[model samples]
Target chain A: MFNIFKLAARNLRRYKRRTLLTSILITLGVVAVLLFVSVSGSFKAMMIGQITDSMLGHLQVHSRGYLSSIDSLPLHLNMKGEQVVRVKEILDGNDAVEAYSMRIRLGAMFSNFTETTNVRLNAVDPEQEMQTVPMLADRIIKGKKEGLLAKGEILVPELIARGMKVKIGDTIVLVATNKHGSVNGQPFVVRGILEGISGPGGRDGFIHTDDALALLRIEGREISEIAIRLNEMEQMHEVFDELKGQLESSRNKMDKPVFEVHTWEELSPFFNIARMIDLMTLFIKIMLVAIVLVSIMNVMVMAVYERINEIGTIAAIGTGPGKILSLFVAEGFLLGLFGTLIGVVISLITIAGMNAAQISFDFGRQKGLLLSPTIASGEVIVIAGIVIAIAVLGSLQPAWKAAGMDPITALRHV
Target chain B: MTLVTAKGLEKTYIAGDITVRAIRGVDFTIEPASFVCFIGPSGSGKSTLLNMIGCLDPPTSGFLEVAGKDVTHLGAKESARFRGDHIGFIFQDFNLIPVLTVFENIEYPLQMVQNWPALKRKQRVNELLEAVAMKDQGGKFPNQISGGQKQRVAVARALVTNASLVLADEPTANLDTETANRIISLMKQMRDEFGTTFIFSTHDHRVVKSAEKIFTLEDGKLQQQGNGDNHV
Candidate 1:
């Protein structure tokens, strides 16, 4: 076996130019794949972080029919106070739950004295909401990041703030209709202006939960939704499953399930874009496979064709068919190994250089967000394994043809 | 005892609708350590007979034995193993692996086929290199060496495994007359030193003159068999 490998290496060296060219082709393919994966992976991670950490959290719990009518912020479908307490108990007891914020979602009329417009609002406990969505404070492009909001003060969306000419310290009136046929209004000062996110929740305003209760004249501690954060985002599905299993069994007096659980993927439109990035990454990988397959196969076939007489001599002198096959395959395997090694080294250096350069770009209203591209070691291993395997697969046909050659005919092949 | 025996040996190749008989029924025996030559014109069954006798090809119909084993109907793999264990081959082109140095080419049979140990294989290759007077050319690749030197390396390679029988098909076809005679003499000397049977096919009268026994083939049939001068 060692002799076979030695011979195979020498054979590759015999055609130095061809071997180098094929190796370069494979190396470029590998570098392209690794770099694309790292950059696109960074983009996806940043996008998800913006949506989840600033708005949705990792997952959320809502009243059974609430999400279907979530666009309208239906007040009658809010989880009653008892259901909130039950859900709170489940969240508190689960180790995976990092923090959760209970919100009162409502539609209101906003007027900055001269201008009036419809605004969607989320009333939250400032401390809990901060803990669940830590980046929420970072989204405040103007005004206070510290307290988020105080009672009788609101954080207006940037679009609304711009349109209504509302600013920090500007007093605004919010009018709302309760579950009953009653209307109420409250005046509040703007504490901050939020940078708008890209999707559905981008235009919503924020206020203190106490102010929402007072404005709506709610009799009990009913809440519209619970936004949950987990210690590890990768475990979102497991935690969602565990929590949903428990919550799904909890019924109202009418014997119907009371809540629905959703991951941030389901709640955000940005996820489709994330999936498209993933699909593009897959297509890049397929392209890498095709590149390796064609290049290695072409080189191996040529090697066999050019060395037919040598193959015949060896076969006639007692080298077996299996040995011939392995010799060619080993050459291909070495090609892949060398190319992958070079490509991985170059890719890592390129990624490091990107980080050192501190590349930054904007997504939606988030600006100067630095892009830090990274690849997991497992991903590198998998990609390298795929290239080497494909190289071997590509060499099979040519190697088999060499192995099956009749020495008499091969010697006369010229 | 005979190293090779063939009774009514024949070979036929079929291509599309054509059936070509390259070797007609013929019988022969070769004694161990003997120098034998087959002299024939083109398409006179010289290479076909040698291929069958070397176990590189199985006869279509015959009773054939080499070193006491019937090889007329051996399977492809078994035939390859048989060839590896019992025979060595040298080609007219001095078909050395171009990538390998002369020493490595000579060591190939032992290393690839017989699974010889490194030290022993090195010793055997060195001995053959010395015997073939290519001791100084061990590190030169085929193209880097002269045709005579390359043929010398081929001779060394064929004897490296101590094979009981060595087959050469037109071993001197590419060499000058003097070089051809020298290669033939070296092959005979190796046969004497290793006690190995050497069977070769050639159109060179000089090569046939040095052979102890010669068989003449005409139209796929052995027309005559005798001592070198008598047969000619």
Candidate 2:
């Protein structure tokens, strides 16, 4: 059986020109798929990491309607005092949850004596917010990044500060409308200036939750949402399930979930763009499979055609059909193996070149991101396995023809 | 003992709606270790009869047995197994696997059918390579060798399996007279040593002259059976 494989390998070398051409196609297809998958995979990881670590966190648990009507910044949709305690207790109990931050999101007007601007403000606990969004405080350009704002103080984004002519330690008025339609105002010192983000929720201001409560007529304890950070991104689904079960089990029967859970992908439209990259990569791989299948099949069929007399001779010499099939199929298999091995080597060199090139593209609030193409050993194994299997499958028809041939008739074929 | 017995064999096939009768009503008995030849001109079904005796193609209507087993009606797989177990074939073109070295071509049958142990297979192939005068040429591929050397490798390959019957279909057709005569002599010497029955289908008079028993065929039917002049 093993000797049959040796003969098949030798046969490939015998038809050097034909084998080389088919193998080049296989090598090209494998290399294209490997490079594309690696580059796209790295790009996805980077973009998702940027979005999650910068603002969204790994996942978010918000009071129902808060995320859906997040644009309207409805204070009435905020989680109630006891509801906040229940959510916090559930989050604290989950091992997957690395950190959680509570926030009161509100629509506010910022003014520095003369001019005013509408701003979406996140009234956050400074310490927890910084921990949940690891890069949030790093975006602050002035004053302190860690201890962002004190009572009666606000953190204004640089764009907003420049527009309103406000600076760190400058006094500003925080004006808000309560749930009762009552307008209220308070004074705050600007503690830090944050860099303006570039996406949908980019232009925002930050203040202490106490300042937010002081500005708004809130009856009891409440927060707009809780953004959660998990130890690992893969833990999102398990944690979301456990957290949702904990929250729902405590609720009355037949009542809807008090909160809607969203993974980072759900929080922004940007993740979908990342997913589109994967879809495009998959389509390209499918094309590679098609090319390999057609090219190898065509070559093997021609091989069988040219070797009709040889086939008959072997059959006449008492080589059975199964061995005959193995003979030809081994040809295809060796073709794939050689090509894939070469392709992998070539892909590694090409990917190294690409990474060294340090290609960059602007994505959301991030710019000049380094492009890193990474191929996991497992991915190379799986893709190579598929290509080789397809190559063998492509050879089955021609091999079968040779195996089932009538020895006398086949010998008579030209 | 009869190594092969064929009685009232008939073969026919459809070709574009016109049925071509390739063999009709043939009967014969062959003894073990005999050097025999079936002589005929073009389209005489000499090759067809050899195919039937070799178990390559089934007879349409006949009782044909080879190596003490009924083989006329064996299916494709069974027939192939039967051929592998009981027969060796030599073609007019030599038909050596081009990719293999001469030794590898001779070893092909042992590996494919006999599952011979590697050392023993090497021994047998080496012995037969020596027997066919290809001992020094075993390292070379068929294309790298001369036509005579290629045919010599083919002969060694045939005898490697120690099959019950060795069938040669116009074995001398592709060779010049000197090479053809040398090949025939080598085959006869091998037969005298191994006692493997050798059958030939040929129009070549050189092969016919060497046969101990000769059957003449014309138009898919046996025309005569006669003893060779030498009868050795």
Candidate 3:
């Protein structure tokens, strides 16, 4: 085995230029794949983070009818009812539950003296809001941040503030509408501008609990939605399941109001698009590996052809065609192994460079900055497996050619 | 016992509407440790006969027994192993693997066939290189050597596995008169030292003169046998 490998190594060294050229092609393919996979990973992370941190949280608990009809305006999901509190208690008991908050959301028009625009208004308890929506901190700009928490003070996104011609310290008159066809008006002081936040929540207006209660004229209504946060991003499903089971059990025993539990995945179905991008990246990697396989096949074929006479001579000396075939196959495997090592090193360097460069992204409304390699170690191992499989498969034809050589003809070849 | 025996050996090749017979109805035997040569004009089937005796080519029809094993239609892998254990070959063009140095080329068969220890292979390569008077040139690649030196390396490579018989197919064809004579003499000396039998297909009198027994062929059939004359 060792002798055959040595011979293969020596033969490869004989044509230094060809070997170098093939290695370069392999390296290029690896680089392209690494960049695609890494960037796609970063994009996926950014997208999911944006959705969960800004809007959906990890899970949402709302009244079943309320979710079915957006016209259920100023509607309270009754999450503060006994049954809802039982579910929340169960979730809060779970070690996975990092944070939980109840909020009332409504669509309304906000007007300052000169202008008006329709916007979503969220009424949140400021203390619990920090745990469920940390991204709100990211939105505070051009004003004191305390306005997000202060009683009867409202925070407006840049878009809403611009449309309303309002700024901090300005009073905006908000008219809240409900399914009962009643509209009530309340005036609130604009506290801050959510400077860079984009998307539905960012473009809408938000207020403290007391202010929203005053605007909606609902003094003692049930809480609208229960938003949850998990210790890790992946624990959302398990926690949601536990909370759902608790809610179901409580509902069976009592004639209380019912709520639907929604995980972040369902509330934000577009998360599937991020996964699709990952699949697409994987497909591209497969194609690239195939190309590398073909390139390796060509290199092995040329190596076999060049060593035709040597193979014949070895066969004549009774080395066995099996041994000859194994030698060439081993050569191909070694080439792939070496190329994969090179690829891994190059990928690490490129990832490090990208992270060092602190690349930022702005895709229309979505914004993000990537500062590290998003490729997991498991994914790297999968890539290695792919490279090896390609190498071994690529070696088959060349090894067969070497093994099938006719000793007499090979010896006679000039 | 006869070292090689063939009965009614035959070979046929098809080349697009033509059947070419390279060897036909040949029966022969060779004794152990004999310096033998098959001599004939081109296309007379001397090389084909050598290939059959060396077990490099399977006989189309008939029995071929080498070292008491019948291997008339051995598979490629089997034949290669058989040859590695029992036969070696020297070619006209000096088929030395170009990438390997003289010592490495000589050590190749030992490593591939014998599974010899590294120390053993090293010792055998050194011994063969010294025998060929290429002790100082063992580190040089085949291409870097003179024609005679290349032939010497080829001889050393053939003998590296300690096979009982060596087949030389017009081994001197690529060399000038002086180099050819030197290579022939070295092959003879190697045969004497190792007691390895040598079989050659040659038109060179110098090679024939070195053979103890000579056979002539014509049109895929053996023509005659004689004690070669001491010419050249």
Number of the top TM-score candidate: 1
lDDT of 1 by residue, A1-414 (tens): 787778888889888999999999999999999999999999999889988899999999999999999988999999998899999999999999999999999999999989899999999999999999999999998998997888999999999999999989999999999999699999999999998888768779999999999999998799999999999999999999999999989987999889999999999999999999999999999999999999999999999999999889889988899999999999989888888999999999999999999999987677788999999999999999999999999999999999999998899988
Better of 1 and 3 by DockQ: 1
- Write candidate 3's Cα lDDT for B125-220 as tens digits: 999889999999988988789988988888988888888889898899899999998998888888889988899999988888878888888999
TM-score (chain A only) for the predictions, listed in order: 0.96, 0.92, 0.86
TM-score of every model versus the real structure? 0.97, 0.95, 0.89
TM-score of 1: 0.97
Q: Please, what are the lDDT tens digits per residue for candidate 2 over residues B1-232? A: 7998989988887779799787889889889999999987888888888888988878899899899999878988888888888788888888888888899899988887879898999999999998998778888988899888888888888888888789998899899999999999989988988999999998888888889889888887888887678432
Residue A235, model 1: lDDT of 95
| TM-scores of chain B alone in all candidate structures, in the order given | 0.97, 0.96, 0.95
Q: lDDT per prediction?
A: 0.92, 0.85, 0.79
Backbone clash total, candidate 1: 0
Residue A28 lDDT (model 2): 91
Overall local distance difference test of candidate 3: 0.79
Model 1, B149-218: lDDT tens per residue?
9989988888888889999989998999889889988988888899999998998887788889898888
Interface RMSD of each: 0.8, 0.9, 1.3
Cα displacement (Å) at residue A154, model 1: 1.4
The list of candidate 2 runs beyond 4 A from truth reads A141-143, A147-152, A198-200, A217-219, A250-254, B230-232
Off by over 4 Å in 1: A253-255
In terms of docking quality, model 1 is high
Question: Model 2, A57-176: lDDT tens per residue?
Answer: 887877777887988899998889888888888888888888888889899888887999888898888889878888787678788866766778888878889888887889988789
Candidate 2 has an fnat equal to 0.96
* Candidate 3 chain B, run of 10 with poorest lDDT: B223-232
